[model samples]
Target: MPEKSERQLLPLADSDDRQDLRADCGSCFGLCCVALTFSKSSDFPVDKAAGTPCTNLRQDFRCGIHQKLRQKGYSGCTVYDCFGAGQKVSQATFGGTDWRQDPETARQMFDVFPVMRQLHELLWYLTEALTLPQTRPITAELRRALEKTERLTEGTPAAVAETDVAAHRADVNVLLLRTSDLVRADIRRKKKDRRGADLFGARLRGADLRGVTLRGACLIAADLRGADLRQTDLIGADFRDADLRGADLTGSIFLTQSQVNAAQGDAETKLPPFLARPTHWDRPGP
Candidate 1:
């Protein structure tokens, strides 16, 4: 973990506020660098086994190649976000003691990182659901889920490590799926079921894709400008090099920052407020 320091806690506006989901790297111990493994692929340049720190990790837990990560075939690192998990594990769970100093505690810290990551991810989605006007019928339940998941994230390393993330995910997923139906009910077009489909480089510009289940779909390099993607379940969908300019993803579910970062988009792209347009996404193409 990085050295512990004072971190400011922002006021939570409401149950829907996602301020807690933002990664606080400044206060984190570079858990992503030392805890997670990477493999040689199009996204990463080399194979890094679990429990081994990447060579680019700095003494202060910052990436030595951060600015040029994408240029150097470390695009995977550029897109990865811990969803505020790293800091929570470092500052709260372990009290800022890093693995380097307390070598014996390294394994437990690494174990807790992924569990906290999943819990935080759920918090992100639950908070997003609370913001949707169409999900008003389930807002109370979403709030309860959000609070419960948030509490789980704050548990001891042992408790977090033993959590049944899959079970909690299944429970929350039911509500998210229902939220999707409510949000896209008005889209009368034929709802596409592209689950696990290979739509790479497909020219889907201006297409009506509302209420679609694009789970695990490969959408790499697809031209989706001006497409209606409202209420789409984009879990595990690959968006590498996909054009999202002018596309409306207003009510999309389970979309993560990494997915948006891997795609191409611009100012006209309508996204959920929780996600930002990737800085590298200027005027875009492959």
Candidate 2:
């Protein structure tokens, strides 16, 4: 297992790094509660339309049921992470003037929120790639991309709303794919390429999946108990309701906190230090 310092590489917070890419809800205006929509499913209890504030949103822009979201049938909210875009849109983009103060601003702010979220998500990935020794060859390009993305996020609301986000994302994804390849290149024999594969509800308990590319794969409700997942690429993978109990994922790349929160785990799950064990997860078995 890597040391705590090594685990801290993902959400790197050095002076040279850009502003935090992690969600700081306190500095946000509950954008996720209003700018995004949800549907009645196992993840959400009620259907919601975009641009409307959630009933649980308080006047102070905080979730009324934040602490008990999962308990209150709002599991989707619990696992949702905006990568700090909420605060960026609330404080930086809008200069701390909330949507309620101006109807036009409300519409524009909501429009820009999702765009900024995607930029910030890309920043998070580029920043992580810079922290890895494997990506040293592409460090210059990664840093350039990170700076470019940061600049894009700082644009005016109109500029942000009009950003060619899909085009930008396509460019950044090329770099991310390279980073993934560099990191996983030396992991023994040819690894499984399950990218975007549908493995929902598949039984994979105690499987050896080292250095595998599980990007965009659907592992929802899959049994991953005690699986060896080190060195795996988990970017965009869906782990909702998957059992991660006792799984070894210490060296996994691109595994975000939201993905981990949506899964089930236990104390025995060997995760990187940067990733916290979900509180709702069961305690280690005796």
Candidate 3:
């Protein structure tokens, strides 16, 4: 890893309206710190159960080791992005009343957090789909799905918790699949279909992966250095500890920041204009 950084040459199209989709910890009630569970592993130093507050969580709903999470054996926290679900739950659904202020609603808030998180993640994908010129044929359907998901986020905590998230997710997945096909339709080369493949720790360095559908692929610790990933669909691919140094992922569809954050990359790695390079990439890995 090097201290130098890379910059995107072009601005992210339609990303100006996505400010709310990015997490705002300052306005959040630290729901992720208390609501999620973790197992002791390479990503975490200790095993913890759901609904238990992380040991590093401070009284003000901030991580005491926020600046040193990775060095302190909490790499899991560094990669976890709730996509702004925390602040929305804290400020809007609960009317700004934190779980601490109303202990009775703590369980409800915790339950609703995951539900809201799922909805927000869909919103993220839908928003990105709408930005693609190829998806213009189904843009109206995408907008309708986005609006319905957005409305779901604004429901009562109980309503949100009880939402048929799986049903809604299935409905949105249909549109997302169509969007993926539309985007990859222009590729001159025959694309690889590795959907849900188990390529864990597989050797694929410098591979030509353009226009491939790696959706839900388990790429944990896979060697992908210098691979060309332009136009690849990476919606739910797991990149934990994957080596992506020198990889080119520009124009890759449905790739999220959290996925990039989990992988090992260097300054030479090319990313979509919308994603920020993980700061830890500048430091030596543990």
Predicted structure with the largest lDDT when compared to the true one = 3
- Give lDDT: candidate 3, residue 262: 98
In model 2, where do residues sit more than 4 Å from their true spots?
A: 1-19, 282-286
**What is residue 223's positional error in candidate 2, in angstroms?**
0.9
lDDT of 1 by residue, 7-67 (tens): 2212232334555567888888889987888889999989998888899889888889888
Of candidate 1, the 10-residue stretch with the lowest lDDT total is: 2-11
Give the clashing residue pairs of candidate 2, or none. Answer: none
TM-score of each: 0.88, 0.91, 0.93
User: Model 2, range 1-286, lDDT digits (tens) per residue?
Assistant: 1111222233222322324677889989899999999999988999999999999999998889888887789989879889888888998889988998777789899999999999988987887788778887888898788778878987899999999999999999999999899888999367779999999998999999998999999999999999999989999999998999899998788888899999999888998666678778864422
Error of 2 at 168 (Å): 0.7
Rank all candidate structures by their TM-score, best first, as comma-separated numbers: 3, 2, 1
The digit string of per-residue lDDT tens for model 3 on 4-36 reads 012111123554245677898998889999899
Which regions in candidate 3 have their CA more than 4 angstroms from the true location?
Answer: 1-16
Overall lDDT per candidate, in order of appearance: 0.81, 0.85, 0.88
What CA root-mean-square deviation does each model show from the true structure? 4.0, 5.0, 5.9
Error of 3 at 104 (Å): 1.3
Model 1 Cα RMSD, 1 decimal: 4.0
Model 1 compared with the native: what TM-score?
0.88
Poorest 10 consecutive residues of model 3 by lDDT?
1-10
Better candidate by TM-score, 2 or 3:
3
